[model samples]
Target: MPKSNTIPVVLTIAGSDSGGGAGIQADIKAISATGSYAASVITAITSQNTLGVLDILPIPLAHIESQLDAVFQDLNIVAVKIGMLADADIINLVADKLEQYQPKHIVLDTVMVATSGDLLLKETAIGSLKDRLLPLASIITPNLPEAAALTGLAEPKDAEQIEHMVTAMRQLSTSAVLLKGGHLEASDESDDLLITQNETHRLSTERIRTPNTHGTGCTLSSTIASFLAQGEDMLSAVSHAKQYITQAIGHADLLKVGQGRGPVDHFFMLHQ
Candidate 1:
């Protein structure tokens, strides 16, 4: 029997977190909570909890290829959210599949580091991600440090420096860049700059203070993908995603999941 296409399907290509706070787990939860069916291809598996990552096991390249083929062949995927790529080989392979399959909206969350201060991607993979995957993405969501790493500049210390960093990032091949400013601890307001080829839009939301902020990047990017899968424009998708993540973070304090950082309430509305 043919599958129904009434509901939009969003694909997440990332790692797996045993703790279910980030990566494939978070992506699935966010996508489903945002009103879309979620599909996934895990690039790596991490023995991770809210505290930190203990070990990482790479999915064999052939198995990764098989997984990509299986999904692209069968699923009616409208959008893709790409997260952590452990090395250059995996990056190249994902780039190849993306180019071959050509999903309509590809949101790349440059997942280089985890909230636990653990490294998720290797330094050697940066060049491959830049040369290969960046060009294929519809938009990239990068936090300050990831943006700095991509552009070879220090992390932006202020709004002016942020603009400068975005200017440098403009040379990259992606259609747009969402430079997340949540890392600026001094700010009461969180401002993320959306840089398109035509114009730049500033997305600002109140910074909610909470100890539970794990999976924020994954959740935000997946939510954006869900919106895009549902036919929202670039700016609208990003705007809605920002609003959603803020609420999720604001409600995060209500849930006590882990000893360290905790996951956001992907289904926060249900609790309301």
Candidate 2:
């Protein structure tokens, strides 16, 4: 039997990237890189490369539930990172599991769109996410496009607008919202706005000029969950994760894994 205070375990509930750039692969890599024991429950499988997603095969809800039950029953999961929900049913299933296990920390990556501008989650699933999952999340990370979609905004142009959208999302969900500014058009820097019930924090970093930006959002959320599993507080975890991702992007390996875009090197720390 495992000891009471073994290595912190973190679970990732998301899709599978066949190319291993994003989704469950990226989540697992990020969790392991941050010194956490990684577990996963796959929601879907995609035949994809850095170029684009060609096909998506969603797993049955029963299988996802079984995977979740198996892990939570055996291991002591400290944190959870939720990504793509293939459909409304899957989203509901995940929500049920969260209510049952009640992990100490939960990071919700609102994975609606892909880096290649592909829609990952179904439109009908949004209602379920907003109603069931987001409320239970400790934090919800949404990129610009996804935030706009959730808030029904034409486009979020400035930081003020971003905060407004986040506030709107907060009204719909009980979790703190982190609105990512990477997708916004900017000449100088990238700004990510994190809004909670009590305060707002603005994190700014230089825009990384690279095409190897795949799996960034997934990496960020999972990294934050890993830090949380290590007993870091919420704001501290987010701040550390921001710095981690910034360094990861700056030192991104220039490997042409696929024809179009490529993944960042999660093992950059090992090489450094």
Candidate 3:
């Protein structure tokens, strides 16, 4: 148990990544790294490693609802980070829970596919997410591919096209959209665009050359939610979270974990 004022509690509703690289595990680690208490309502369990997902066992909707109830009933949840919803029912369940609890901030990581190119959410879930979850999100973070999928656009090849895609995504979600540029090809810099109700801002960083980026998206979204839980405004929270993930990627240890791509060292800055 944490002191009432001391621990800022953040809840993550996502899948479990057995690789410990991404998903709920990464969310918890990122939350803790930012000095926030982490709680979880797991949507699915994956038999996966850095290489790929071998199997997926989705938790029943009832159980997921129970988990949400158990946490929100007791804890003062300050913020939420959502990831890896496996189906429409689960997405609706989460949306209903969010509506009931109304956490201060909601970071929606539109986790459509895995890093290894596996589709994580079902086809019907896509519609449910857009119709139900998008409006409730405080910030929706989608990588290039996911953004393209959500907006039904062919992948944008240039920054201008990417901006167009971001504009399209803004219409779908009432919240701020952070369209990540990790998968986009670039000559000089990797850039992420933040489009909100008020303005569109670009955040550029020197692209880190590393394969050890297994959980970067999950880590970044959770980091932002944690900062929001700690009372940072949306833009400042996102800015700091971007800086944190960049440093994590840069300092990623080349540990040959699982004989494939490895995870960013979330604990890297602490041990340094």
Q: Give the number of the best model, judged by lDDT.
A: 1
Model 2 ranges with Cα > 4 A deviation: 1-5
Highest-scoring model, TM-score:
1
- Per-residue accuracy of model 3 over 1-272 as CA lDDT, tens digit each: 96666789999999999999999999999999889999999999999999999999999999999999999999999999999999999998999989998988999999989888888998777889999999999999999888888889988888878877866876885579998988875536779888987798888899888778898999999999999999999889999999999888887764456777788888776757
What tens-digit string does per-residue lDDT give for candidate 2 at 1-272? 96675799999999999999999999999999888999999999999889889999999888999999999999999999999988899998999989998998999999998899888998888888888987899999988888777777766887677766766766756668888899765636888878887788888888888888899999999999999999998889899889888887776755557877788788788877
| Tens digits of per-residue lDDT for model 1, 1-272 | 99866999999999999999999999999999999999999999999999999999999999999999999999999999999889999999999999899999999999999999999999999999989989989999999999999998999998889988877878888999999999997889999999988789999988888879999999999999999999999999999999999999999988899899999999999999
Question: How well does candidate 3 match the true structure in TM-score terms?
Answer: 0.96
In order of appearance, the predictions have TM-scores of: 0.97, 0.95, 0.96
| Prediction 1 TM-score vs. true | 0.97
lDDT of 2 at 217: 97
What is the Å distance of residue 65 in model 3 from its true position?
A: 0.8
Models sorted by TM-score, best on top: 1, 3, 2
Task: Give all candidate RMSDs, comma-separated.
Answer: 2.1, 2.3, 1.9
Kindly give the stretch of ten consecutive residues in candidate 1 with the minimal lDDT sum.
163-172
TM-score of 2: 0.95
Clashes of 2: 0
Better of 2 and 3 by lDDT: 3
- Which is the better candidate, 2 or 3, if ranked by TM-score? 3
Question: What ranges in model 1 sit over 4 Å off?
Answer: 1-5
